[model samples]
Target: MSHAEIEIERRDRVTHGDYIAKLDTSDSTAKLSWTDRQGVRHAEHTFVPPEARGKGVAEALVKALVADARQEGFKIAPDCSYVERYFDRHKDLSDLRA
Candidate 1:
């Protein structure tokens, strides 16, 4: 349950995308999902399994998403409740908000 053991990956489709966080030593995973429209990334949902709860899996997923947003030059619409709170906590990334 350490952040160092978590590896996050992005999966993008035609109109939607997801960030998947996997633990290198286990089968556990966490996910954050979003849709794209007119260049805005609509963050819609985040799912962290019960076993992975309180272990920073969701945080890793969100961080990966935000990193991609910054590197890809895209804005994010925080439709997911978790993402909304994340953004609220980190005002430094407000420039990436949609």
Candidate 2:
């Protein structure tokens, strides 16, 4: 099935705690994080509201993070289980995996 049409962008800055990324739609929002270790960006944490689940917000967030990492020449560590599986399901995105 086709996923939602998600728009991705680099966060200008981190404001709220526990939120490294975000996905906002007409009716919902999702928060996420790109895990960093020893000055290296590794993985991410994605949280989609229960009501927003199954709409592909998490997938889009993971995809965005992967693209960002690749653009910056970094590898992914995937601390989030869902993010890891997202990569497993989409080989094109695995280039970011550490």
Candidate 3:
């Protein structure tokens, strides 16, 4: 499936300093964090079930995370390898990198 075909939902747990972008099913989540000091957010982990592979679900999640960081005036430390690579390809968003 394409990015447009996936429905990604953001669940924010501000009390826990974490957020998750979940696919329609609960099985997959791209987990992120506000786990660091200095107001930085971390893109920590992305999990796509085998059935969801190649569907752009993970990319959609990270894109939403990046968008949030941009709008919310926070920088991102992409600890997840996928997110790191995504940043590498989109250097235009480097200003948001921490």
Candidate 4:
């Protein structure tokens, strides 16, 4: 599915949450998972199924997490390699780092 056709959902529990992306036209889903630790949000993994590649699902997941962090006043630890690189490249996000 294209970026606009994907739907992103936030699934949060006590200690962790996932931003899950699902294609409107297919069964494919992608996720960016994170855990909450001592007031910080640690980005754990980014997963994109092969069928969902090149559709911005991964980026949308991370963006959702970042949006939450900003609005909720939590810092982020980009533990996942993809998130680490994303944080590295986005200078505006430096202030949000943990």
> What range of 10 consecutive residues in model 2 has the weakest lDDT sum?
12-21
Q: For residues 1-98, could you state the per-residue lDDT of candidate 3 as single tens digits?
A: 56776655666666325445555655655444445547887777767766666767777878888888888898888888988999999999999999
- TM-scores, each model vs. reference: 0.91, 0.69, 0.78, 0.90
Name the regions of candidate 1 deviating beyond 4 angstroms.
24-28
Q: Pairs clashing in candidate 1?
A: none
lDDT of 1 by residue, 1-98 (tens): 67777878889996998899876545866799999999999999999988768888888888888988889899999999999999999999899999
* Tens-digit per-residue lDDT, 1-98, candidate 4: 55566678999996998899876646867888889999899999999987767877788788888889899999999999989988998989999999
**14-79 in candidate 2: lDDT tens per residue?**
321233323354355676666466545655567887866787777767766666677767677777
RMSD (Å) of each candidate, 1 decimal = 1.5, 3.9, 2.6, 1.5
**Top-lDDT structure, candidate number:** 1
Whole-model Cα lDDT per candidate? 0.88, 0.63, 0.72, 0.87
- In angstroms, what RMSD does candidate 3 have relative to the true structure? 2.6
Sequence-dependent TM-score of model 2: 0.69
The true-versus-predicted C-alpha distance at residue 2 of model 4, in Å, is: 5.1
User: Positional deviation of 29 in candidate 2, in angstroms?
Assistant: 2.6
lDDT of 4: 0.87
By descending lDDT, how would the candidates be arranged? 1, 4, 3, 2
lDDT pick, better of 1 and 2 = 1
> What is candidate 4's CA lDDT for residue 77?
99
